[model samples]
Target: MTGAPITADRLASLTTYREVVQQPAVWREAAETLAARSDEVAAFLEPLFALPDLRIVLTGAGTSAFAGEVLAPALARTLRRRVDAVATTDIVSNPREMFAEDVPTLLVSFARSGDSPESVAATQLAASCLTSVHQLVITCNPEGQLAREHSGSNSSLVLLMPSATNDRGFAMTSSFTSMLLSAWLALAPDQDPRLAERLAAAAEQVLGRPDELARLTGRPYDRIVYLGSGSLGGLARESALKLLELTAGKVISYYDTPLGFRHGPKAVLKDGTLAVVYLSNDAYTRRYDHDIVEELRAAIGSENVLAVSAQSDDAESWQIDGVSDVDDAVLTLPFVVIAQLLALRFSIALGRTPDNPFPDGEVNRVVQGVTIHPLQP
Candidate 1:
């Protein structure tokens, strides 16, 4: 369990995770498809994106919400457009607060199953209340209600992600990352051609060196902190969730930005703790990020610190090479690839199934026992 176990069953489980590790390829496929549909998305989205009074809203729940978290900041920076990632849970309860009739709005919804109550409800409510609104639906379950409900509305676009991303276990391991990558491809087409290749290589690199991450996870850590900045923050949050969910609350996990963590959250770095820092590739950002990490190294004596970055901060840095020219936004894959591997190794350390890390059913693959409610009048 300390290394990449190559048993048939474990290897099978690793298959989905390995495929997910190839997220750069997945992103490439999504980008290529989106490119092919550029005319369609453009002809359809140009005016909507160009609206003088337009707001682009990204909505989802759980890890799906994290997808938007990763894309929103990067999109705003690159596209220079007003974009936001809001949870469907928030939108369903407070439509007026999230929507406005004064502006043309486009709601980009990410759903793993597309059947989540809030997913459909939020979509319906937005259409019902907003004067000019469009829907961009991304989901794994093409047969789910969200995909089926699209009525050829000129404003609606439903894109299906890869099949391996449609996870069947109680946790969204691959599916979550896949959907998130899909959005990145859809939103940023001009990044770099080598981005996907670098990510694919990173996947193989991490999987090949699984023992390294597995050994780190095998440590006795009661508290874990994931520190990141920019789009990588979303990946940090997801990584923290994976450890928490897979371990069934045995290991407490929290996610925060590098600078933000020093404020008060850093108090969690007690003995038997793990700190995972995701440093940015942007020259200035990484400098600040590494500075914060250096601070942690000096003060957090008892906690084990693991730093992942596209460039080397010091000898301790886990260099995610081959992503030199790739935008840090797209280069996020290497850090995420490493984080996912860490989570899996941690699951093994805790003697749990990486496939279904949650044994008591507190967390689930598609989520469960929730009624998909209708929009309240």
Candidate 2:
């Protein structure tokens, strides 16, 4: 018998799964909107930046947390802020180490729902224990309790991402990229908003070529590794997680920084492995990213590899032009869309439903069964 049909509503909601073929415009709008607000956010954050000893904490769970992973390095280098991506689960379990005393912290929280137990708890923990803690929440859900935390309080700022990011399906597709873009722009407002414009245009261009991605995803591969440098390193982690989650573990996945991949993780690449590398546009960073790709290509083979980049100049790379002229923050969307589409295509090809890949339900849209504990002084 033929399999059940994927309904139009289901297909529409699948856009929320992060497939590049779906809703690229939503991704673009998010990048543009966040970039346009860079100045306003930077102005609000000037005092925090002025503090020489301030600690910038980026907190979230799953993909939300990965957004921080992508932003931490970029923020550290650009804004000169001491930043770290701490999972809320870790923060709630051990508060002292995550929030050290005498540290003036600006907690940048990324949340899709803003209602997760750990997300709300992390915010409360920061407020209760840290005397000089401030918050800048970037989330898709406007009604999320986390968003309301800043209401009537100048001490907190919440930037609601594009409405579409409040992804209806289980997986966090657009929400992740949109929140990441907001935090990046929040750090670099002086850059041109057109960067975001070009990025959105680029994403649309990539989405136009779903058949190209389909060919890649349709290929037979049992293992996947995503490599990136700087902010894109975190993007690698998120991409790996998406493939693993959506495929229900049929495909093993890994993520690492470009330079860090040579350490001991290179052993995972086999004859049938699909390895993806994120090439940076910056000349300096690109050297490291491209060198690794060249080394890996010679070690493995070109047929089993894919390279995503801002420029198509590299003959072997999937040229995603436009974002190179923009800041890394604005470029994040197109880069992430590539990963999202790969995960979705892989899921469908593997005979798993993209909406609910894990039929046994080991994971859900909002995580469950966690006990909330109050932070103790």
What are the lDDT figures for the candidates, one per model? 0.74, 0.79
Instruction: For each candidate in turn, give its C-alpha RMSD to the true structure in angstroms.
Output: 2.7, 3.1
What is the model-wide C-alpha lDDT for candidate 1?
Answer: 0.74
Local lDDT at 93 for model 1 = 80
TM-score, every prediction? 0.90, 0.91
> How many clashes in each structure?
3, 0
Which digits, one per residue and each the tens of the lDDT, describe model 2 over residues 130-163? 8898898888898999998775578888888878
Q: What is the lDDT of residue 308 in candidate 1?
A: 78
lDDT of 2 at 320: 82
